[model samples]
Target: MCACPAQKLCTCSASSLKKTSNHRKQKRLFRKAFFFLQRLTRGNQTDTFRGLLLKSTCSFMKNSIFSLILLFSAALTGFAQDTIVLNNGDVLSGEILEQTASHVYFKSAAFGSISINPRDIAEIRFTQDQLGEITVPKDAIAKNEAKPPNLPASKKPEKAAAKPPQKDTSKKTKKKKQWSGQAGLAIALRNKTTSNLSGVYKDEKYETYRLYGNLNWKGERNSLRWDWTYRYSEDEYKIRDDFFNITQKYNRSFKNKNLYATAKTLYQRDYNRRIENEYLQTAELGIKWFGKDSRVKLSTSAGGGYHIYDRLDSSRSNKTSVSLPKFIFDENFSWKILSAQELEIIQKYTHLGNLDDYHLVFSFGVQNKLVRELFLRVEYKIDKDTEVFYDDKGYYDKALLTSLVYKF
Candidate 1:
């Protein structure tokens, strides 16, 4: 098994021998590269090159190889791509989607569609693939500039021939309608205990929940919308109150004018107020200030409507139906305080045939964006009625509520 001399033995296995062979091959390749570089420099710099190559470690070779690979990749990327060189020495290589005097639309793999201002760009370069030709060297271009190439008669540039007018091929498109709406819920819960001088103990649990929503559709000249609110509350003993109201409105703006016409209808039911059913229909001529998309908006209208309702007797034993003509005044204001926040206030007053029989309702609300199509809403509302059939003191209610809202 021993092929070497007396005390010396070969410790090489098959793997070790393969590794040794690889090391020798690498040394030969390194020597060839060193000699090539030495010949290429071939001057006083030859000694510097030789010293650096011979004294460098394997890691240095690896880093140099990696840098060369990166440079080659960059060169290949620049060959068939469009480029934009920014004034701050930033470079982008991608396909140019469009170019205009003011802006350039470019698409890149790293970034999606991008809009770049022309002023921010220092230069632009496009590929010659579109023309199916390659560029020549600077020396050849300079020679051509010095002496124009001779051309035959047909090859010379000629004045463009006048062409007939082209027919219009584009079709007219209708304006698209925009739709938006929101839905929300507000709820409250409470627990209470009461004791009398007679030691009569009473405990009650109260809870209230309200659900509301609105839907709106807007077109070029016409818009339609509807709103609904439902509230129900109860104590341990029995249901305290149940209320519901819904209104639908249709509006049309006059062409080339700020005036608009509105038609609205409302239906309501309230168990606490002894309102069996109520219906109102109103037509109004209104005026709107500012554009529809403006940050601030104000609108007001005055109208007359027919109101019909049935009310229960004071004993809650009999129902009486009555219809009357009423007057109405409505005003609305909205402000966009921030890109993601909005505030709105609305006031409405109704007057029956008797001056003493009237009601006023005021509502204020704010919506803050939480995420896409979702919001946090805070609302304050007041309802005051000067006349009542079952109670001596007029009805008055106020509430401060918060809810989570979703828009679509």
Candidate 2:
């Protein structure tokens, strides 16, 4: 507990100061009178001064001495009071008059009564039990204003430390899809005829239905793809053609370049042109002319491999099985004609054993997006084989397909 009032003290007015000054003067006068009275009565001669005067003077002197002792005690008590330490390294010896959430009211001999922000106070110490009680705890001082231990209260406080920046967790990177696949079913009209300038033989026209699908999986450095095709043809009376083909390819791309390496395997079966079974394997190096999603894309590749085929013939010379070295060339291109439309072309040329014996296939297609993950496609294909196995001269085949495709 402390004696300084919680409220501002108005006792420092001019009148109050005048009263204190009068008290000091009175103390001095009393000291002189007490000495004077002592000397006068030193011999214990009461009779000389008269009993009434001597008694009154002795009584007055006793009261004055007691008042002087009280004043001296008050002065000494004021010197011994409470202490307060500030955050700015300032030390204060004073009485804590009042404490509030926002301010600390203090009374100091040097600064007098003043209000201080609680944030600026570092510590409070009470030297006497009689000092006033504080409802607010010493820890109520704001944490932001706390000082370092190495610095003394008399030195200036150091600048505040800078705060570290926060991380941005709201945004994240998304991964790209690694696998893509498509399946399609189509109906086609096809024509195959060996006769050209002269109508020495008849031409064959048939309606065909085909189903095809492809699966592709790609990674940072390599990729794999598989393609499948199946077709069946019928005339007015019977099934004229049945065909199926499947191919698988693996590719590895060079680092920081558009070049790539590829290996492929193929299996095919067709009964119309007397082809019962065929197998092929190839290795090639290729380059991309544009990015995967570019508006226009073109690529070409050349490779060599061996071809094996089994043919059916009732004639005198029946080639049931044969394997021959082959040379191959492939071209692929695509163009996006509109926001939802695209055109594609693909051609492959294969030379089997002899120079005159070769196979060629060319296809052109247009795809229109019909809806999400769905497309309508139309394609025309031309196929020719220079080697003839049956009565038919070099085989020539043509087909037009309309298909519905779904992708995921």
Candidate 3:
């Protein structure tokens, strides 16, 4: 069969069309030959016409059969995205180098690993996990329960095959490969009539709240985290404030795993009545412990830094209390009630010499599929002293919010 270069284009990819085109061209040739045979028999005797038609039919069928074999061969060659299964129930998508009764050799496109035994494997499969330019199919998780080859059906007996060598399962038991990541984005709004931060509270119920997002990138061993939070309220003036933070984190679940810690820095910009600019710098070292239970997880960070408060320039009291950074402790926890919902709590303690106060952050949220590619989040947050606002009197703030999020 003659091949066409441009025929490679398809509704999905260019590869499949080339194979289909070759099959279709053979079909067209078969149809043409059959029609020609019928035309030749139009002016012939009964015997001659029957023989001619029979001969043409056989020839076309032969060509069709050959075409099918070619099509199947082309479909299987040089285009296989095989999945490799591990003993600990882990799977990797890649190309297969060898498939035998005992083991399978594979080479990963993203992460590299070597020979794998199918005995400890649950299954193996091939799929279209790879799609567009640098994008893989989200639903490309395929599984095959194909069992090992059985003994021949022949009555004659043959020599048994030798088994392959085993690897160090002890070391494998000590370490496990993990797939971990977290990412989220949110926006919120609030309104207060007319409120005062300090010195006799008034009615200022106009405020807007927005939390940009946090992106977590997981590497082979470590992870990088970037996150920010922002809230803005408008009374007679345009007031906007934001809090930004970045962290480089490490996590491990195995006993022999390395230390899990994080180094983070945060900045805040607030425009309120009493204090305008509040800035803080912190460096913390902490450890995290989690399991597949997902019911409970805890993380604690303790360190020291400097926080500036309004230059301590209060003219009201000559005995003003300055906001000096002494020590800080942060505690965070997450409880997964269900597969789609979670309960989280955050607490931060600020020890500023004499004026020490703690702010509590707690929320109850459920991650549910609102619609196609859409998610709904409803959370209620209350602070014992929500007065984190500029010049907020020693009081906490409370609010409830709902959000609709879109994802790609």
Candidate 4:
């Protein structure tokens, strides 16, 4: 166990330091006294024993200083004592448990049951339980602080005078931040309805299977989002790591009555490392909002983007003739039909400068949250394109999806 720097030191630990310090003090005093005697009688005590004792004393001091320096350095860079001070002075020293808005729980003591809170609490404390007289705040004290049972009622101030107005701390509300994330697998099967949309190619089936993982850190005034996705083709090996992407999104709620939007950007120095290619950068901006939070369309954002895909993997590759710039947009929505299910939709468009090819995609999905932290999803999607796609681009034979989803 380490000393808790937050509170006072323990007596045993302090005693150890005191003992080592006294030893050093005795050594220093002895050396000082010897030096004083030498100064008092100049040129006296030039004996071998006296010289040996001085050398030994000096060597021991040098070694002690070095040892102390090493010990301090080792502990300094190591994990130092940490503490989390809560507003109400209740200290929690380990990971906390959380379920939803209705209740929250935390481990306030070791091998102790978690305390559930119906009322919103201030922040949670995270620290090691160091040994000392922990300072429990006034709020955690007994309710009758001003009254002493032994006091005479007549001697005490008249009831009203004894009760000084308590400070109005009603506005002091503290809410600890919560962590949230989603883990779901998206299973999509695409079919083509119109062959002319793909032009040269007929209805072909392609699968776009994606697993999305996100972690959201909730905070006052703002929140941070980390998203990572892994997508692949179920039938054909069409795209490589090109199907993967990562993004950081910042979210906030403003006072605006009916406006909300999510703007994002992406950057990658190398699309393919084994085979060098031009740097890739994407910039998207859009805003789509709702009339109200309960309006089914939890949130909607419409943003335009500029994308640049430089050199292709091979110099002779015709996919990207030169550095390209294009437009991009996305829209997302959610509708709750049942406590166990939600309906979702998304639409996006992309254009490239090289061949003037345009792409548009629309998708509808249903998600069922069957258990705590588990979900199932199904979706249908369509793609409209002017240029011919080799194997992966065009929509499935009918531009629709039929598949089973299992999420963890």
Question: Global lDDT of each model?
Answer: 0.70, 0.74, 0.52, 0.49
Model 2 compared with the native: what TM-score? 0.56
lDDT (Cα) of model 2: 0.74
- All models, RMSD in angstroms: 26.8, 20.4, 35.2, 38.4
| lDDT, candidate 2, 330-362, per-residue tens | 777777777544434333344334467888788
lDDT of 4: 0.49
Ranking by TM-score: 2, 1, 3, 4
lDDT of 1 by residue, 245-349 (tens): 999999998985578888889999976556778898988888988786888878877778898999775555699997988887778877777754444433334
* Model 1's TM-score against the true structure: 0.51
Q: Write the per-residue lDDT of candidate 3 for residues 1-408, one digit (tens) a residue.
A: 436654534434766768999999999999999999989877766888789999999999999999999898766643656765554668787765544454455667565545554555656665653333332233332244565554221112233467888886767464442333333445544422223334344444444556555556556556666556555545554534433333333333234332355555554443332333455666666666665455676666667767654422223233223356646666666665554433333233333222345444445555555566566666665434333333455434445666665544
Instruction: Report clash pairs, candidate 1.
Output: none
lDDT of 4 by residue, 236-321 (tens): 32334234567776666555634534545554332222113333343443344545546365444444445554433222254553
lDDT comparing candidate 3 with the true structure: 0.52
Highest lDDT: which candidate?
Answer: 2
| lDDT at residue 399 of model 2 (Cα atoms) | 86
Error of model 4, residue 354, in angstroms: 14
- Using all chains and alpha carbons, the TM-scores for the candidates as numbered come to 0.51, 0.56, 0.43, 0.41
* Model 1: worst 10 consecutive residues (lDDT sum): 139-148
